[model samples]
Target chain A: MARQESLNVSSSPARRRGGRKPTISREQILRAAEKFAPEELSIPALAGSLGVTHAGIYHYFSSRAELVAAIAAHASRQLEPPPPGPWEDWLVEVAFVLRGHFSQFASTADLAAIGTSVTFAPLVEALLRVMRDAGFTIRQAGDASELIASCALGGAVVLQRPNFDAAALVEDLQVAEDSPVHELAASAVDDDADAAFRRRLAVVVAGLKASLEAPTAS
Target chain B: MARQESLNVSSSPARRRGGRKPTISREQILRAAEKFAPEELSIPALAGSLGVTHAGIYHYFSSRAELVAAIAAHASRQLEPPPPGPWEDWLVEVAFVLRGHFSQFASTADLAAIGTSVTFAPLVEALLRVMRDAGFTIRQAGDASELIASCALGGAVVLQRPNFDAAALVEDLQVAEDSPVHELAASAVDDDADAAFRRRLAVVVAGLKASLEAPTAS
Candidate 1:
């Protein structure tokens, strides 16, 4: 149904241009969008870059928000979770898939803030399947899915920021060398953002496993 | 030294007013700022609310960014961690304190994005101390602190967005009622944002415990 809707929208330009095939496909537009960072992507700019009129772009995506949503949908389709395996391995693959997706299209983070919940169904389904297979009840699996999705997207936002200098922030705070904040900042300098995210992911996975094993009070 | 610097800035107005004592103090201004949401906070707006001239506002905070930093610093001071206890209890308290702080000042989420590494020093110190007492090495403690902090702050960001209707999003996706996305969205509707966050925090704490007890791979 979504594909049909996308096709109908994309074909409008060709229809208006007297039945000539549309000069551009939705896939081509998304590919062009992929070239710019989320912050730098604008429809007019994208159209200009593609050598198409602004109206041509608008025929497919009515507004920038719609374009962003389409981009998120496109990215979601590209995410190929590894073949089913141990729950732990499955989750690790999920995390890498998410990181790769968000890293490639940074603007998805912004969309997630507003409304990308629907676009995220595929990834959420994959996580849910893994958790359910690992013995989480439906309710538990749902909560876990939300938790993991939120963390991955949130972590991506932190990592994708234009400027994040832990050392500079520490210096601004004027903390002593022995302070915990100083230690954290110094350690952050040693590890890249991706490593830090993976460490966090490990903690989250471990935490979930322990919680699942413990008998619930209810 | 920080206190001296604050005094120097706050006292400038008094000196400019022929030593008659400034009509407002930095504390008074901060008190007013605390009443407004972070996004609503502005130097001129705050000054207007306080019945002071815009110039009077600058006598203390030089810019909106400086004011936000001061607000974060002030919020940090107000975060009094409980005396040493079980690591779980300590982390739970930290999460609540952070959520309370960020919820009270919405813009702190934005600050957390930019430079929470500094503002969060006290809470980080408290968490580090608790983790160390629980037998985590310095490096492990540092990584755990970052993970927990990131989760708490990141969760807060997700919760604080202006409009988040999971059901509406599900409807927009046009998924069948039995579909995994529908199930996830429906389940999400049943759990309030705070409960979801607490669940995630529980997982982080559990993860930390498991990691600490596991024999080091190194």
Candidate 2:
């Protein structure tokens, strides 16, 4: 009975938070910033919209850049955990998740681009860990991480815009018979971009292994 | 003799404007915009820096957006035409030229993003013409042009960042011993990335053709 009532209340129109002590949490702040992005949004404007003081925000974020970084971190964390499987298969799964995550929060890419100076190091380090565990040497891990993220993020940014639809973009690839954009598609000259991605992934992995085998340049 | 004097007068810092009159021209305005992009750069700032009244710009560009669009068009025309060859062989060549073009004008990508809205229709038509001429079917030409342009442009935007050293980025992929970045010694992962890009491009091309052959779902 309590669960049913809570669901009903949660689904109702958002309550106007005026008459009470503003209980703005970090999540709420991040959510607000994400909502107002790609527009002429300012920290003060966000605070005003949330019925909170600008000064109060400093309790959570030290600066506007920091706030943007926090939002990026929040958005990045929203991505699902990489699936448990063979390294090759899991790598593709991870790329797909990343593609979806970036698509969902495409505006955040621009916001994150501006705030990159803050501390993407932590997130980058985490990414490296995933790659290492997936059988990549540190250097191979580094390049693979950068390339994968770039493709996914770049693809999402293109997909989210008005002129670029993500599904249509994938459909254009005509990758597989059962599911054209699915993992089953063969690497045709014009149809299977995923095949191209996998080939690239394999090369990076092989290169990394070769580099590891020969530490010094020949 | 006048041309010789103009070319040789470089020893003298002081030279008359083009060894002729200072009358305004469309080329002159656009050239000035390109030259002044590195400094004070608002519409008014560009006009002021050029020692012209803001209204004076209207003779060449009717609006600020038009002025920006013209600069982008100028840069686009100045870009190296994609090399004529096998698709894979020339694709990286195209990517390199695009990277250089975007890097030349720091904010040109952002401007192009805005300008594509106004120019997409005509641009698409021209792109289709080029692709068809290059051995693609009407549909393959249409879809491939859009997808490939997006990839190249998106790659450029990501690669032209302050942290992204293009020389370093491509070093691993160059197979030739004489390549400059090859001296930098690419990580195994970077080699893989080069391979992956080739595969991805192939897939995109093949998929595009396949999609052309099949009827798209309703």
Candidate 3:
């Protein structure tokens, strides 16, 4: 009676995990994935750490790629689109929102960098609606939203590494201190990626506005 | 004579790989990595596939991440700076050069997305030299180059996945047909990520130009 009651009380959907372990939910896999560095994600290794057979974990994900993608999708639930406002502000907020969410799941951004884009759909509807009101045609809105996300994402990827500083790169390459490359690095604030990203967004927004105002410029 | 020549023929630097296999060089790891899907990269698995132990593979690369980074760095050798010309053209060419190189090695892009910025420095000096001649302050030139790289990188990441189509995403989310997002999706031509990326670069460039032309507009 006690064993029967325990099984019933567990209430996991797929309790028969090849009879290896009683329950290993999708949530459990995602939880574990959150703790892993981007490079550390291997399905068999993930399964081993979870005390489940590799095949058992496959019940939830078709492949390791699918499994890794699901972790980002799961995290996307927490990201809410900001309320509608000025077009530039809206886009900047969206960029920041992306930075906030993906910062925790660097692998998702890494996956994007590699060739698998992790689409976070929660913000799209709101983003599209705002861009539409800002005088962009539907395609423009969609493309613009994608552009902001990409910049935000790319910026996240580039800034995620502390070693990616301009000064460090110039020095490592043996660039002369008096050269133009070194001069560019000289005036740069080494640790201010956030500020640099903000400036980047401003430039992106200005370019979009120019395109909108003078349609023939592009 | 053949046996004596065989050892000499194998001129790879690290000929001592724990006797796991007579020879496994850094070049071998890079060659293998080019064929691997990003999700399929595991140090132990890579070692096993190469008939080497994980430790033996580590003799060439200190870590899997380092191995991955080196693959990109190796490929960067082929990317040369374009001859100096119009600043805009130079920047665009640089962006294209990056796309050309990274597109073949998607994992490098993925690593940048994940938080490990892969620095490809060959073209930076020339890029800075051009930007400086175009009247940008040293910091401005550095920041602008980084911005272009980010947009190009972000665009690469977003477009790499065939499944990341706007129409498909909208359809999957059950967005209403008349809605702005759906309309954006409607105007979208799937499988034209390259065209979209090109347009995105144009906009980013325009924005940078606007910033220079009207300094306080931002």
Give each prediction's DockQ, rounded to 2 decimals.
0.24, 0.05, 0.41
- Is model 2 an incorrect, acceptable, medium or high docking prediction? incorrect
Q: Could you give the C-alpha RMSD of every candidate to the true structure, in order shown?
A: 8.6, 16.3, 7.3
Best by lDDT: 3
Tens digits of per-residue lDDT, candidate 2, B24-80, equal 556667788877654344668877877876656654455554555566655665454
lDDT of 1 at A200: 70
Whole-model lDDT, candidate 3?
Answer: 0.66
lDDT of model 3 at residue A23? 57
Task: List model 1 lDDT by residue over B131-215, tens digit each.
Answer: 7778887667876765665555556556655477767877876756666666665666667667777777788888888888789
Off by over 4 Å in 3: A1-52, A107-109, A113-120, A163-168, A176-178, A215-218, B1-53, B107-109, B113-120, B163-168, B176-178, B215-218
lDDT of 1 by residue, A3-94 (tens): 54554566545434344434677888988987877768898799778876666677678777567767766667666767888887678677
TM-score (C-alpha, index-matched) for candidate 2: 0.46
Q: What is the TM-score of chain B alone in each candidate?
A: 0.71, 0.55, 0.69
Q: Model 3, A1-218: lDDT tens per residue?
A: 55444444443546435454435667888899777875678877887788776655676677666666677676665578887779898899888887766565554334453223335365766777787788776666766776777676666665567554666555655666567866655666553778878888888898889788985632
lDDT of 1: 0.65
